[model samples]
Target: MPQGISTLAADTPTLSAANTGFMLICSALVMIMTPGLAFFYGGMVRVKSTLNMLMMSFISLGIVTILWVVYGFSLAFGTDKGSIIGWSSDYVGLSGIGITQLWDGYTIPVYVFAVFQLMFAIITPALISGALADRVKFTAWALFIALWVTVVYFPVAHWVWGAGGWLFELGVIDFAGGTAVHINAGAAALGVILVIGKRIGFKKDPMRPHSLPLVMLGAGLLWFGWFGFNAGSWLGNDDGVGAVMFVNTQVATAAAMLAWLAYEKIRHGAFTTLGAASGAVAGLVAITPSGGAVSPLGAIAVGAIAGVLCAMAVGLKFRFGYDDSLDVVGVHLVGGVVGSLLVGFFATGGVQSDVKGLLYGGGLDQLGKQAIGVGAVLAYSLVVSALLAFVLDKTIGMRVEEDVEVSGIDQDEHAETAYDFSGAGGGAGSRKAAPAPGDSVAPAAKTKKVDA
Candidate 1:
């Protein structure tokens, strides 16, 4: 639209292409993490509801993709009106936003950027369902995700990444998504947990993972995908920012793993697989905000601190009696806060603004800014998300019928089984299930045998 800024300019093509390519790859990477999330969450719940948990994440691949193309992208990245929300002028319904436009100044297609961002939009809401698992109906959950994205996720995205977002304007540095993804999902998770109430046997039963292997697999996938997520934020391969982020990602995660194992061994007498996975995730969350800003050493500190803090926070659910089923709030929200705040202190090499943090002898100014950003993000996300959740609950009836919930939504809503090796497949919709041994395997074996 401006002179000397042709969408087809040579430099523009390179920069745009890089941005587009990286983001598209990141989007794909993020999508895989949902299944990873399924595994991560599946292992945390009782075997009976594992498929249902996995379904929640998978559904986003369909729902959010459609929504983002239709209106979600416009609301998030379209022309800014008042710095709160976007307009439809940019690219509504995939109009005029072609590959050339995508690499307008970057290296990839604009579609790539949109699609990559779409992956993020889709997964952010899925992160919250863990808290509401084994309770909500699939239809209700679907409706809620659709509504919540419109009300909660979109606005927050606008505030953080959109052209005139308040946080962006305020100089809050989220290299990836400390406030946008982590804090927003974490706070909303707490809201839904309150609305949905605890799982049937949350505290009473020792609900072990249906499959530890699945959990480990999910953790591995998430860790891999996160590289795309964090490094891709740079929007291109520029000045080794991506490499720095890539290395920090591993460093912090490793540090967190060790810290968590150490703490668990000291406190619980076991270095649980769950602890290692959780620690990796915690480290990832903590480094997300400051990955590009801090040194590798700084990342280790962030990771270790996040491990200890998140481990401590997870216990809070039990003490306070809120069922954050998969520790989304503890790990994402608290870890995000830690990273966002700590970056102010540990930042070096002039990676960010002129501001230096307390540890850097810049005193408390930067730290105060970090605190303000955290509070603002937390408050905005919590209030908007709660309101959105309440609205969805009232309009569509958020929770499923008690019987349907108890039976599992895979059968009740989708008439599907995640695993179907045997022919006597699990039946549909809230039927009373006789307690069978080996909850995860028998159904599949019987289904396969029947099929044969």
Candidate 2:
């Protein structure tokens, strides 16, 4: 355990009521991030697929919650089996765990700790929905979430955070979840997209986001919730570290947003709302692991670097021919890498841990360790995610039928649409129906002459 943390006897109650309440509030804040993600992803997809995109995120809240309570927690935070995984039955159903019992090194009850971790589990899989967007079968996606968390997320979380976990034992620093959440999900997103293939009209079609306002709303909520996500990782407010993480999270996100806008104006000729929102998320991902270790300026550096790098990275799909619908691979995976690696250069000791980085005269030691952690997690997540996706694709079929996709995934998959245009006097009551994938209207028909 880190220096200040103390292990209490099993029967002792060292719980602080104030800290417990704060953690619960933070858990609720983090819980809102899934819906925020839904809106973020929903706005990026075509109007026809909006509801399906939202549903993909919503279902994770339902599915992962149940699984977490049953056995997910055990596999993630239970007794360590090897350095790779936790014992599957140790904390099964949270059995034998006392509500009043405090987790080691924390003033909050174990139950609060369990529930806070549950929020992390919920949002991690939801992050992948952006990559698969319009083409996946709803059933296949739900199944994927269940299975992916089992094989990929649970083990990886253990490796990063569980007691006796390999990376944790190696003194690898992931304050919140740069490795376990963002990088893991981003790599998994890539694996799924590789197998499921691109959207029907990926590059050829103009697949612009349907609503910028909704995207902004989601981004705002994510920003609001991320304070909890980063700061709450401390598990208690007794120390001043939580405040440091909190400030770092805010400044990093702000710096990243500005960097993204600047990049957009220079590259695309206009500053776009999409760029700003994506930049904010990129910063959030980047700072998640390093916020507690770096100074405010270091946070800015990390965020700004992530913002610029991820902005450029979003174009990689076009160059490489893979379609990451909402730039999940670019922003999350790439941003996570930027933040995790930068810690080796910017970690100032006396903030969270007693460690210094290269710039602080710590030399190449910490930098090399960061590289090892990043490489191990990325390789493991990519391989296992690809295998899982391949098995599902071969057995149950990962995508919807071509007709269903072209017409609309929302109607076919969920029998619902995000926007109802039936009330608009556009002639037909159901004029909101999407155009067929390859359908084209005559130029004359598409053109509407208006009185000037």
Best by TM-score: 2
| Ten contiguous residues with the weakest lDDT in model 2 | 1-10
**Candidate 2: tens digits of C-alpha lDDT, residues 267-349:** 99999999999999999999998998899999999999999999999999999999999999999999999899998999998
Model 1 lDDT, residue 336, Cα: 90
Error of 1 at 200 (Å): 2.4
Please provide, for model 1 over 430-449, each residue's C-alpha lDDT reduced to its tens digit, 9 standing for 90 to 100.
35565598666344343344
lDDT of 2 at 158: 89
What is the RMSD of candidate 2? 5.7
The TM-score of predicted model 2 comes to 0.92
- On the 0 to 100 scale, the lDDT of residue 215 in model 2 is 97
lDDT of 2: 0.90
User: How many Å off is the CA of 352 in candidate 1?
Assistant: 5.4
* Top lDDT prediction, candidate number: 2
Candidates in order, TM-scores: namely 0.87, 0.92
